[model samples]
Target chain A: MKNASSFCLLLVSLITPSLWPIIGHADGVFAFSPEQAIHVRTLAASCAACHGTQGNAMVKEGGNTSEENNPVLAGRTREDLLSKLLGFRDGTRKATIMHQHSRGLSLEEIDLLATHFSMQIRVIRPPLSPQKLEAEHG
Target chain B: MAEPFNRRAFIKAIGATGLVLASRPSLAMASKPPMGRVVIVGGGYAGATAAKYLRLWSLGAIEVVLVEANRQFVSCPMSNLVLGGSKSINDLTFGYEALQANHGVIFRHDTVTAIDAAAKHITMLGGTLSYDRLIVAPGVDFNYQEWPMLASLDAQKQVPHAWKAGWQTVNLRQQLETMADGGVFVMNVPKAPYRCPPGPYERACQVASYFKQHKAKSKVIVLDANAEIISKKGLFAKVFNETYAGIIDYRPDNAISHINLATKTVSTEFDSVKADVLNFIPPQRAGKIAQEAGLTEKDYPWCDVNFLTYESKLVPDVYVLGDSVAAGLPKSAHMATNQAKVCASAIVQLMSGSLPDVAPVFANTCYSFINDHAAMHVANVYRYDAGKKMMVSAEGGGVSISPNEKEAGYAHAWANNIWADTLS
Candidate 1:
């Protein structure tokens, strides 16, 4: 194994200075306590696998107008996020898999997630090109 | 008492040592001091997600050290497409650079040798590190106890398992490519409760899809240990019987009894199977690190954990994630990342003297491609059942009505977003 003890220490010393700006922007509008914020943020983070981190869903270059596009969630108005989520929950709207997810959460939790996502600063990434593959990756 | 290793003192020490510290831009100063350090083993979907979320949720309070044996991550979720010839191993492979550079996670490319849980220290091949909490997200390890002869590294190169999505994946693809027309390709599914329940069937579809387009005379035989198809049974059956009728032969309840490596033949109780290329996915259990750390039960192969925190029921302050955890759910990549988020949130709260969320709810959506262009999905939402102390599937969870080309785009998009989520 490669020893990186000193490098690890250097990385640690640099973390606080580099990471604070991304995280320090306080979302003071949450009606819940700080503890509840942790829970909701985690719940919202689960969506990142399909949606991009902070709900900025990735788009193929030149904009993919396919049924496959995952809707961007960050910076959407709170009312829109809540209504759409509630629709998915109450069967008022049709979806591929969103209903299954929305149905699992309570109305309050859904509202929290909606508010949480709306607060995120959406960074629509530069149009991404598909990854190219070769026979020998190494 | 010894002095606490405060940030100022640590930076001063590094400065004294003349070590060059890399930085981007200084931000608003953190109000709280460092709470603790978390050392995570394994850099797959689960561990990588946990490390990222722990830092993000904690606001740079808790330090994260991610130790992974491999420098690059190769996803198993899309590896089947490589067999279908629509993708390659290079497409699935990614480096940890973004995960480290962006998140400020201390990336250690090392292998764990031993774990002293009582001392809260992990002994790696390079050096020992102490942690307040440890997350063991090592994925499944193949169990070759039944056929020890095939366990060796050299033997694996000959009859590839190709289950873990690495060199063996490339090896298996090459074998399929070089096989003569009309040649038979045989693959066996290990018993259920293994990693990715639907993966074997998906592999069959991928191979059959390749044969249909290229080698029309080639045959794909699936020898499953289960009584029937384990997951998405109806959909897979439709694809096998209707989509690739003559090309695919799916035989259920035919577990491998013995293998003749010299002749590339496999024997089950009822019949003998001779193949031009053989892909045998053996039985699997919690990864070797989990077993060595005493995270798994004595009788069972998987680990038992507190459903809310994913902290091991066997080991205190040590959590298990991903396919290693014994759950009644499918061990898909999405499921693994969801579990990691829950675990990361719980640990952050626990470190800060706050209670972890009790009623954790998450969703799992897994897609299976019938061919290169058509795909289907099985989606479910899981809620923590306080009574059972486990995650149970919620209502409104179901499979796609049928495979379609539209869902295929969604599948690839899902892969892209997940790769970015876990790594970047």
Candidate 2:
């Protein structure tokens, strides 16, 4: 399997640049190794379905964007996020769904998630506009 | 017996390898690495989420093309509210503009006619697209073998399924609106492993809520093929028995044996029911595209996948997601998006010559509204089980004790956040 992988790598190097676009200059560089960054990003995205992408949770129209509305986790201090996650895991922090989620995660994973969200840059994005239903919908 | 990897599969796998090694030298020079294109079919929750995350996690390094038949996204999650009159299809509809604008994902509003897996190219109505990796997330297609009479589009117009949350949803809502006060609204629940286990029950509640508000004399007859409720049993049972006691007639283990469209009647082994508005949600399998691509097994309707990467067990370089995947987990929108994220992560890692997370963990949260402003949820965290080679439910995961208004607030917030997360 190892030999096959290396062979595949060699073939990829010879073929991919011809099929795909090459960067003119190095851009969108990663600080962490490619694998580590992808692992953490995938984990963080699991929370995105409810918490907005990168923990910038969106609120209802005309609703306040405070902690009351699914509280934004991005750009917070690491200590604050870690303490809250630990509290949720330990049953100290009361939550409707967080407790259920936090209890299943390992302590190490919770700490990692806290650090992941803390590093994200929070931006107050405009809420997406809902499209009208078509007269003849499929 | 391992099937030999085709030349197309080898090329894709190598493309992934190129993404890794090419970037290493580029990183040393403080530049970005070159990456290959990924073509995703069916832009529902699974495909759309995959497209967005592939671009997001790859930081615009990878080219992602999303091919969808529809112009807008109609959510199957909150779509039940459309039947109860609490929300409109418009409120649940969204365009792909955000995904294209924010994530730089290429959007193609065209239907895929055929997928040549061995060639790594798709033949669509408009044109052909080649890719290094293919993600097929076509949700579900209703099975009509048993009731061949209801297979036609015209038949669906009268006895609608409304399962996909589009034209059928509108048709069903209109049928209910025009129904007399004393009319009977009959709907059936397909057997287990259908899309959204709690969905049929929630639809019954929505129809009942609508009837209770406008037509006091109307009745809702729920004919479930399963022996009992498959999801949120305690909560759904309580709501059916107590809240809509007189309005809802809950019948279990009553599989449909025959349908008489002219008579507006459905027959089981021992019973025959006629209704003013008939909702027939037939048993389902993977979408036709997956079936055509030879993704599903000979006996099973769903495509088997490695839960870690959601890569097809049958085909190399072809990943399956959403309701199309055969799994023990509930086929909910949240589960589909989570699977998409995991698949996207694996693809990114694979392209860069690194191994995917061996112990991938994720959560699935599903909210079912009992009414316009009251809801309940079932949530769980699942981790990859090495022995089973699939995701298994972890500890501390279950359903809500009861339906309440607070969850309703969270439910709407969930819709907004997930939409933004998926599209923007």
Candidate 3:
């Protein structure tokens, strides 16, 4: 038993040096790095409902009723988009809808969404011809 | 194939490796450099708060230098009330003496001419200064050329963009004072990417409130460049419709295209509107210093940096904060102050050879006063997202008070708290 205790102590001493690697791994997991694309993709799952799969924003025939007060972010500059998201998150660009959506997001999620949307090609969706929609519905 | 590591062994391994890594040359290099100096530009909310927090966290290990072009920072946050005559400019003005005495910040009253990011040195009108880490928060500069009509000398003389603090604010207020009782005061709200998104609406509310009291015959018309006004829209509309019914007219989705200053008329994409007094808030970007440093993207002013550390991605040992950074934080004094604290803490950790485990939580409370006695507030918390390279908001974030008298009173108190927290 004494020999086992000494052996365990020796083993503990040998294992101590490896502790930094674990800490380093933890730091890697937590650190805000540029290559967290997978994590970003996972976080962006929640945004697919409104922003669409890749942030192309799925606008229904009636328009986004939930976001009627806000403009659809289909195609905008990354800087412009990021600023708006920041504003919404910080309550600087307050809207009941955006405030709720933004408040739930972490900074990482915001960055991920901003990055994902920032790279999206700007495609101007022609405004719905109101008369045509009305006639079709009628 | 390998045996499962027990908890004690795992902990011991972690502890031992931490010690070894702690003894590495790189880790040792993280120790506080010999009296490292931080030179910050701009003395507004960002710079002042940064200097204070840096001093606090460093415990007098780092030297804090603040360079400000203006003698005093006249807060742009609540200056709308000043225009409405509900408050004085004196109430908005704050000096750096308290900051210097209490925080041990070295204040240099000078304009920054250029920043040599390569050398980590900044050239100023007064002298050249070197910094271990430079924090640039020079606020914003208006792009008059964005609207050609407003850029013309004749038009500029008549229409004022009181977006920037100091003379601009005073000029706009004076123009309002000179307007006839029945004159129309036209305020233009620029599109996104402008400083203080809610500012224009807040200004309109205050102006409408003022006209109700002093210039009842005069009406304030808001021509917005965006599809919708930002923040507290329901509350603002309700208050305006109920309290200042005929005094205020709001139009969104109306982008101002031109201004015929000769005739005091402005043209938007939709229609033309005439005014006796026009306040045009043009689109904005980061300041010139940031642009010269190659820190800005195409038309956007400001450097892209790690939101948690405020460290420039392009330049090492250089931090960018406030409106000058593409931080996924609001461009408000409150957000800037929190960002300054985060940056300061990160700098401390980097210098002290210790890992900072503290998670950064940024809080912002924006208060908009509908009238002298009543106000509205919105607050939120923000955290960093490395994967997305952005900041995101918490879900189910802050709410405006539900039109209760008690809440209104609290809103007033909140405003007082904001003013004290920012300036005092």
Q: Tell me, by lDDT, which candidate is best.
A: 2
Candidate 2 C-alpha lDDT tens digits along B1-424: 2222234533443354345446555433322454888999999999999998887666556778899999989888899999999999888899998777656677888899898889898888888888899999999989999889999999999999999988889889999999999999999999989999999999999999998889999999999999999999999999999999999999999998999999889998879999999999999999999999999989799999998899999999999999999988899999999999999988987887778888888888899999898999998999899999999999888878799888887888788888888887
TM-score winner between 1 and 3, please give it: 1
The alpha-carbon lDDT assigned to residue B177 of candidate 2 equals 97
Q: Where's the lowest-lDDT run of ten residues in candidate 3 chain B?
A: B1-10
Error of 1 at B313 (Å): 0.9
**CA shift of B408, model 2, Å:** 0.2
| Residue-wise C-alpha lDDT for candidate 1, range B172-203, written one tens digit per residue | 99999999999999999999989899999999
The Cα error of candidate 1 at residue B182, in Å, is 0.2
Residue B172 displacement in candidate 2 (angstroms): 0.7
| Candidate 2 chain A weakest lDDT stretch, 10 residues | A18-27
Q: At residue B123, give the lDDT of candidate 3.
A: 85
**Stretches of candidate 2 exceeding 4 Å from the true structure:** A1-37, A64-68, B1-33
DockQ of 1: 0.27
Q: Name the lDDT value of residue B211 in candidate 3.
A: 83
* Clashing residue pairs for model 2: A26-B31, A26-B32, A27-B32, B16-B351, B20-B352
- Could you tell me the lDDT of residue B26 within candidate 2? 41
Q: Could you tell me how far off, in angstroms, the CA of residue B103 lies in candidate 2 after the best superposition?
A: 1.4
What lDDT tens digits, residue by residue, belong to model 3 across residues B1-424?
Answer: 2212234532342343344336544444433433577889887777776776676556556777888887666767777887878776666666666556544567777788988888778888867888888888877766766677776545655777777656566667888888889999998888776777678888998888778888889999999887776776787778768877888888988888877777888888779989988888888777777777777777556579876678888778778778777765567776776677677777866776654423455446676777665666666656565577567675466657544344444433333333333332
